[model samples]
Target: MKENLKRLFEYRELLFNLTRKEVKVKYKNSFLGFIWSLVTPLMMLVVFYVAFGVIFKLRAMDMKYYAFYLMAGILPWNFLSQTLTQGVASVVMNSDLVKKVYFPREVLPLSYLGSASFHFLLQEAMLIVFLLAFRVPLTPWIFMLPVLMLLEAVFIAGLTLLLSTLNVFFRDVQHFTEILLMAWFWMTPIVYPISQIRDNLPAWAAKLYMLNPMTHIVLMWQRITYNSPVNGPASYSMSPAGVIGTVACSLGLLIVGYVTFTRLEGRFAEFI
Candidate 1:
C-alpha cells in the first residue's frame, strides 16, 4: 500500500495527463464543452420537478418540489454513475497505457474518476449558487461537505478499481455495469422520499433500501442542503446508522478492490 502510494506520488505527471485527457475526450467536439454537465442535471431536475412536483403534487415534508429534493440526489447519483461507467472501461480503454506503463494500474481509473469527482464538486458549487438564490441558510453543518466529499472519493476509487480490473476478464463488464447502475439508481430514493414509499411498502422494503449506500448519502445531503437539524427530522433528515453503513460498505469495497486489482494487474497486458 505504501509502495502504491509512493508510485502514485512519483507518477503525478501521468495522473494529470490522464485527467486532462479524459476531460478533453469527454468534451471534444461539444459546443458547450464542460457546460454539458450542468445541462444534463438541470434538464433532469426540470423533468422530475414537473412530473412529481407539479403533475403529481408529491411533496416531502417542507420540500414542495423536486428541484430542491433532486439536487441532493442528483449530485451523489451522478458521481456514482460516472465513476462506475468510466471505471469499468478504464483498463480496456487504456490498453495502450496498461501494456506500456510501469506505474500502478489503479492510477488510470483513479485519474479518470478524480476528474469526475472534480466535476462533481464543480456541480456542487453550482448547486450552492442555486441554494443562495433560493435563500437557503448557511448553517454550521455545511462544514460537513468536505468530509462527505472525502468519504465519496474513497468509495468511488474502490469501485473504480474493482470494475476496471474486472473488465479485462469480461469485455461485457461495461454493458452489465450500466444495467446494474440503472437498477441501483432506482433502488435509491431519487424521484421520491423514503416516507412516500414507506406506507406503500413493507418494513422489509425499507431494509432493502438501506442496502443502497447512496440512499443514506443522498438523504444526508438533502438534510444539509436544507440546513435542517443534524441527524434529526426537520423538513429534512438522515439515519446515522444508514450513513455509517454506507461508509463501512465503501471502505470494504475499496480494500477488496485494491487487493483484487493488484493480484490480477500483472496479467492485464496479456489479456488486453
Candidate 2:
C-alpha cells in the first residue's frame, strides 16, 4: 500500500491530467456541454417522481415532498453508480497505457472517481438550489454531509480498485458489474425510505438488508439533507450503531480491494 501511495504521489500530475481529461472528454463536441449533467438528474427526478409518486402512490404515503427526497437520494447514488460503471472498465479501456506506460495503474480508477466526484458536486449544487427554492430549512445536520460523502468516496474507491483489476483478466466482469449494480440499486433505498423496507420485510430480512453498506450511506445522506421536517418521508435517522457499520464496511472494502488489486495488477498487462 505504501508503494502504491508513493507511486501515485510521483504520478500525481498524470492523475490530475487524466481526471481533467475524463471530465472534458465526457462533454466534448456537445453544445450543452456541462449543462447535461444538471439536466440528467432533473430528467431522472421527473421519471422517479412519476413512477413512485403518481404510479405507486408514494405521494400520498409517508413521503410528502417526494421530489426533494428523491433528488437528495439520487445525487449520491448516481456518483456511486457512475464511478463503478466507468471505473470497472478503466484498466481495459486504457489497455494501451497499461501495457506500455509505467505509471501506477490505480490512478486510472482514481481519476474516474475524481471525474465522477466533480460531476456529483455539480449535481449537489443543483440540489441545493432546489432545496432553497422549496424553502426547506437547513440545519446543523447539514454539516455532516461532507463526512458521509467522504465515507462514500472511500467505499467506492475500494470497489473501483478491485473491479478494474479483475476486469483485465475476466472481460465478463464488466458485464457482470452492470447486473450487480442493477440489483444493488434496488436493494438500496434510493427511491423509497428504509422504513418501508423494515415495515414490509421479515425481521430477519430487514437485518440482512441493513448489512448493505449503501443502506447506511443513503440513510446518512437523508439524515443530513432531509433531516428537517418538510412533509416528506420521515427524515432518516441513523444511530451510533449505523455509523459504526458504515465505517467498518467501508474500511473493510478498502483493505480487501487494495490488497486484491495490488496482488493482481502484476498480471494485468499479460491479460489485457
Candidate 3:
C-alpha cells in the first residue's frame, strides 16, 4: 500500500491532466460550455422549488430562503451522482489506454471524481453568489464549507475507486449504479428536510435512515449554507456520535476500496 501510494504520487501529473481533459471534453462542442453546469442546478432548483416550496408548502413551514436550502443539498447530490455515473465506466471507457499504459489504474476514477469536484465547486460558487444577491446574511458556519467539501470528497473517492474497479469485470455494475443512485438520492434528505423522517417514521426506521453517510453530509451542507434560524435547528439532526461514525466510516472505506482496487487491478485487463 505504501508503494502504491508512492506510485500514485509519482503519477499525480497524469491524474491532473486526465482530470483537465475530462472537464474540457465534456463541453467540447457545446455552445454554452461551462454555463451548463450553472444552468443544470438552476433548473433543478426551480423545478424543486416550485414542487416542494410552492406546491407542497415546505417553505411555508418556517423554511426561509428555501431556494438556498434546496441548492445547498442539490449541488452536492449532483456531484455524487455525476461522479459515480461516470466513474463506474471510467476503466471500460478507456480500455485502449488501460491495455497500453503502465500507470496507476486508480487515476481513471480519480480523474472523473476530480472533474465532478471541479464542477461542484463552480456550482457552490454560483450558489454563494445567489445567496449574496438575495441579501441573505451569511453565518460563521459558512467557513466550514471547505472542511465539509473535503469530507464529502473523501466519501466519494472511496466509493468511486471501489465501483469503478468492479465495473471492469461486470458491465451490469455500471447500469445498477444508476438505478441505485436514483433510490439513494431519495433515501438521503435532499429534496425534503430530515425532520420529516424523524417525525413520520418509527424510531427504529429513522435510526436505519441515519445509517446512510450522505444523510449526515447533506445535513451538514444545509447547516452551513442554509442556516436560517427557523429551519436551521431542524437540520442539526446529526449527533456527535453520528458525525464521528461518518468520519471513521469514510476513512475506512477509502482504505478498503483502495486495497480492493489494487488487488483486482491485475485482472482488469483480462476482463476488459
Off by over 4 Å in 3: 230-235
Candidate 1 per-residue C-alpha lDDT over 74-187 given as tens digits, one digit per residue, 9 for 90 to 100: 887898888888888988988897788778887778887878887888888898888888877655676798888888778888888998888999988899998999888888
* Model 1, residue 173: C-alpha shift (Å): 1.7
Candidate-wise lDDT, in order: 0.79, 0.85, 0.89
TM-score of each: 0.91, 0.95, 0.97
Report clash pairs, candidate 1: none
Expressed as tens digits, the lDDT of each residue in 1-272 for candidate 2 is 78877877999999899999999999899999999989998999999999999999987775767888888788999999899999999999998999997777888998999999999988887887778888887656887777778899999999988888888878898999999989998998888877788789999999899888888888778777876343234433576787897898889988888889878888888888
- Where is model 2 more than 4 Å wrong at Cα? 228-236
Per residue, candidate 3 scores C-alpha lDDT tens digits across 1-272 of 99999999999999999999999999999999999989998999999999999999998777877888889899999999999999989999999988887889999999999999999999999888888999898777889988989998899999989998888888899999999999999999888878788788999999899999999988888878876564436426557887898899889888998999998987888788
| Pairs of residues clashing in candidate 2 | none
Which candidate has the top score in TM-score? 3
| Model 3 superposed RMSD (Cα) | 1.3
Please rank every candidate by lDDT, starting with the best: 3, 2, 1
CA shift of 45, model 1, Å: 1.0
